[model samples]
Target: MIGRITNQQQLVSAQRNVQTSRALLSQLQEQAATGRAVTKPSDDPSATASIMRVHAQQRATEQYGTNISDGTAWLATVDDALSSSEDILRKVRDLTLRGANEGTMTPATRSAIAGELEGLKSDLLEKANTTYLGRTVFAGSSSAGTAFAATPAPYTFTGAAGATVQRRINDSETVRVDVDGAAAFGTGTGSVFALIDNIVTDLTAGTDLSARIGQLDTHVSALTTQHGVVGTRYSRLQQAAQSNLTQSTALEAQRAGLEDVDPAKAIIDLKSQEVTYQTALGVTARALQPTLLSYLQ
Candidate 1:
């Protein structure tokens, strides 16, 4: 009776051990195949919460990268517009200087120069109305139509009076995406249209326009200064874009390390789990079989 009781207890213990090993093998196989420690909250509540947090962080990083890309594209368009404006302004300034010199130019020659100046003014106005992807770059927040409204008086800015749209590149950094049309093309005395009009009127009337030549020089100088400022801002934006790209790449790699499984590691773990499961099955099968007590002694 004592021997039988001992054998029964050993059988029960072996059965419990076999059940535990089977459960462990199942879990190990799932982990190796799916490469996830927890398939559901029931598997591991704490690990599920951790996975959720990492996913949220990865989404935020992706959004920030998108913002950087969009901001960079807008800044590039602005830079191109500014460059074209600078070239046009230089041409207008040269024409004014040539017209101002009375000794070499006849009245007819001055009139011809005035006509060319008028054409350039129209070109400048067209450039000021530059659009990117169907939206005006200088239109402030109102990009529904043209940035500068055209009347008989000349081109005039009709967009929002003081709305400046800014793009945030980082936590503490922001840049104005649209250059105010009034500020870039001028509002009162610094107005390009006014300067062109004054020169045209003076030349047509055959008056001493030499004094107005100085005004043109001043306008050109102011435009040059504005161009430099825009150019510098563009350069900074380019650098910021590059830095954001690098940061995004690093973040992607980090996220992959946290979430993506290495195939080699998974395969090795799968093989190990299979071996362990097979061994457990063999042992359990042998223990469950009838012993020599079944045969007559």
Candidate 2:
């Protein structure tokens, strides 16, 4: 009776060892295959926390990329409007030069140039009222309709004051996305529109206007300077966009490393697990088998 009981105890111990070994081997296989120690909170609390943090960083990076794209588009719209305004100003400058040569142009010729000047002014006003995604690009921070605010009244700046529509490019850095219409075109000390208007008025009255050519030349120079500023800003935005794209790509790669499984590694681990489980089953079966002496007893 003692011998039979000892044998039963030995068999139970062997079975327990096999079960424990199989469980550990299965866990190892899963870790090797998934390249992750935790599939859920129950698997590993610490690893789960690390994964959550990495995921949050990825999400924030994606949002930052979105902001960069939106900011870039806004800057693009502003740059385009400024470029158009430059072209219009160039034409106005040419007309002014022609008007200055009063010896060659008759009064009727001057009047025709004035009409064209008015048309150019209208085109410039349209550019000043340019919008991007429903927001006025030249209105500064004020959302008031009509950037130029022309009421058949000449030489007036009815738009909002100061620079507005700033965009954040980094944690502590922001850039203004708009050039105020008043600063760019309306009547003021540095106003391009007022210069053109003066030239047109002088030409319409059949005035020699030769003295105003120097002032018009200065206006053209200022417009050219502003255009260079806008061009430089556009280049900066392009650089930022490129940097963002690179950062987003790096973040995606890191996220993939954190979450994605390698198929080749998974297949090898699965095969090893199958072998370990089969070995455990064979050993358990042998240990659980009844002996002849047990039956006799």
Model 1, position 235: C-alpha lDDT score: 76
| Candidate 1 lDDT, 1-297, residue by residue in tens | 454545466568777877777787777677667876565677767656766776776676566667666766776787788778778878887887787777788878987999998998888778778877777887787754777665743566766777866777766787777777777787544577777888888877777777876776676676567667667777777877787777767766665665556767767866777777778778877865666773322
What value does the lDDT take at residue 244 in candidate 1?
71
Which 10 residues in a row give candidate 2 its minimum summed lDDT? 183-192
**Model 1 Cα RMSD, 1 decimal:** 3.8
Q: Candidate 2 at 289: error in angstroms?
A: 3.4
Prediction 2 TM-score vs. true: 0.80
Q: What is the TM-score of each candidate against the true structure?
A: 0.82, 0.80
lDDT of each: 0.73, 0.72
